[model samples]
Target: MRAALFQMTSGVDPAVNAAAIVDAIGRAKAGGADMLFTPEMAGCLDRDRTRAAATLRSEADDPVLAAVRDAAAKAGLWVHIGSLPLKDERADGRWANRSFLIDDRGAIRARYDKIHLFDVDLASDESWRESSVYGPGEQVVAADTPWGRMGFSICYDMRFPDLYRALTNAGATILLAPAAFTVPTGQAHWHVLLRARAIEAGCFMIATAQVGLHEDGRTTYGHSLVVDPWGAVLLDMGDVGGLAFADLDMGQVADVRGRVPAITNRRDIPAQVTLA
Candidate 1:
């Protein structure tokens, strides 16, 4: 399976972000990517609560999603429309960080709302309270693709290893982690964390990211990456806006598991208590 990781620098305007994504999808198709995955926040990253709320659209009303569905059909490629902000009127008008999987026929096969909400205070004085303006999702989603079962996850979800573990155990050969990692954490832990996840799960990890400062003055650590099942870095781009394509040989999953069968060697024994 040939996959393309489309790294992007999405601005605050939904229209501009949509145009950028359409072009990237075309390029990925031209480069022979059977499937394409974009980074989190594919359309607009406005931090302002009022602005974000005002711009939110339902799945049926989202124009960006419409374009992506059409583009996937035109190129005859499976596409993962990274996390989009969907308007939710229940929480005094909030948004849901949602993702969509488009089949080759340009029809949405599955949708996943981001289950983990990022409500942390970063060291860069860059604090984000995603739950304050966005409602958290309860469902964990996986899509069946031509290649294999592809698990869906957004930015902050990468830090949680159990999610990936569950995915791989549930017959997922590839896990997609589309993120908008901030500068501080991305610089320190991004690559190592990604490689570790791939090694532990024995799965191909595709991580596309936002590469630079956004229109909201939020700087994202943009090192998009692809890691093999054996904890090897296949591709890593530092602050570049483009697609990273790699041939995912599903056959390697067997070899990697033979080498280090970590996933299957778990013991449910009680943990040793620390001397408090």
Candidate 2:
């Protein structure tokens, strides 16, 4: 299966971002891509809490999702709108960082909210308290598609290897980590972490990311990538707004697993603690 990953520098307006998404969909279709994946916060990006709150729309009312869904239908392509910052109905004031998997017919096949919030304190006063604004997701997700059984995750989830193991155990052959990662962390650990996940799970790992500076003054380190089961980087779309393409060799999953079989070799051990 052929896929296209969108590296975006989204702004505060959902409408404008939606238009750009539609255009990218068209380009992906033209490029003979069967599936298209986009970066996190493709719907909108704003640093100011007040402005971001005002701009967010409910999933039912989001124009960005509606536009991309329609575009996918028209082109007969599978689409993953990596993550959208939406108004969460269940939570009173907090929002939802949600990801979607759309079929060729424009139907939503699966939905995964970002379970891990990016609450971290970086150097030089660069910090974020994502959990304060967005409620965390409770469920893990894996979806069946024409290509393979796809596992879904967002930005901060990359830091957690256990989640990827769970998904792989649940029959995931391809893992997606769509992100809006900060420059410092992305530069330091992005490639290493993603490749490690792929190597461990024996699954292809794909990460579409947000890049460049936004209107909100936040900058993302964008290097959208596709890693093979052998921990090889197939494609890397650098810090720019564009598309990264790659073809999946599904047989590699079983081939690599047959050799290593790490996922199948399991042992449970109790932790031993000695009083000091």
Candidate 3:
């Protein structure tokens, strides 16, 4: 499968971000890409909640989502919109960090709200409290595609191995992790964690990321990567933001799994462990 990964520096305006994605859809199709993957917060990346709230909208009302669906349909291309921050319907009034899988016809095939939120205090003095604004998702999602069953995740979700194991157990051969990572953490853990997940699950790992400085006065480490089931880095778009492509051999998943057999040999751990 030919995949196009868009690494972008999203700003406060959803319209501007939408335009970038729309243009990328055409470019990706022209490049003979069957699917396009975008980074998390592709709609808008605003740090200030007060300012972002004014711009945030429900999924049905989001201009970015609307535009991308239209563009995807026009281009006849599948799209994995890494994640969008949308106003949730919950009584608590918290929002959702949602990922979407759009079919070639522009229909929403599946939606996955981020199960794990980034709540960390970084050594670089950067801190995040994602749960303070976004409610956690309860479901683990996987959807059918031309390539194979694809698992969904966003940003901080990469740190959790159980999630990937669950997806692999659900018959997913390709895992998607869209992220907006802080430079410090991205530098230290991004590649290793992504590779580990792919190796452990014996599945392909596609991680498209947000890169460079944004309008919100924050910098992101932008190494958008695609890892094979054998833990090989297929493509890595460095700090610069643009469109990059990778050719995936779906056969690799089965080949690697047969060689390692990690997933088949996995034994469930008990909830309680006795002290050694």
Q: Which of the numbered candidates is closest to the native, going by highest TM-score?
A: 3
TM-score of 3: 0.99
Alpha-carbon deviation at 75 in model 2, angstroms: 0.5
Superposed Cα deviation of residue 103, candidate 2 (Å): 0.6
Q: For model 3, give the 10-residue run with minimal summed lDDT.
A: 88-97
Over the stretch 204-254, how does candidate 3's per-residue lDDT look in tens digits? 999999999999999999999999999999999999999999999999999
Q: What lDDT tens digits, residue by residue, belong to model 2 across residues 1-276?
A: 898998999999999999999998999999999999999999898878898888888889988989999999999999999999988545466888899999998999999999999888889589899988899999999999988999999989998988998999899999999999999999999999999999999999999999999988899999999999999999999888887689989999999999999999955546887789
Cα-based lDDT at residue 67, candidate 2:
93
Cα lDDT tens digits, model 1, 61-166, are: 8888988888889888888887788884345666778888999889999888887888898776877888887787777788788788888888888889878877
Instruction: Identify the superior model by TM-score, candidate 2 or candidate 3.
Output: 3
The lDDT, on a scale of 0 to 1, for candidate 1 is: 0.84
lDDT against the true structure, per candidate, is 0.84, 0.92, 0.96
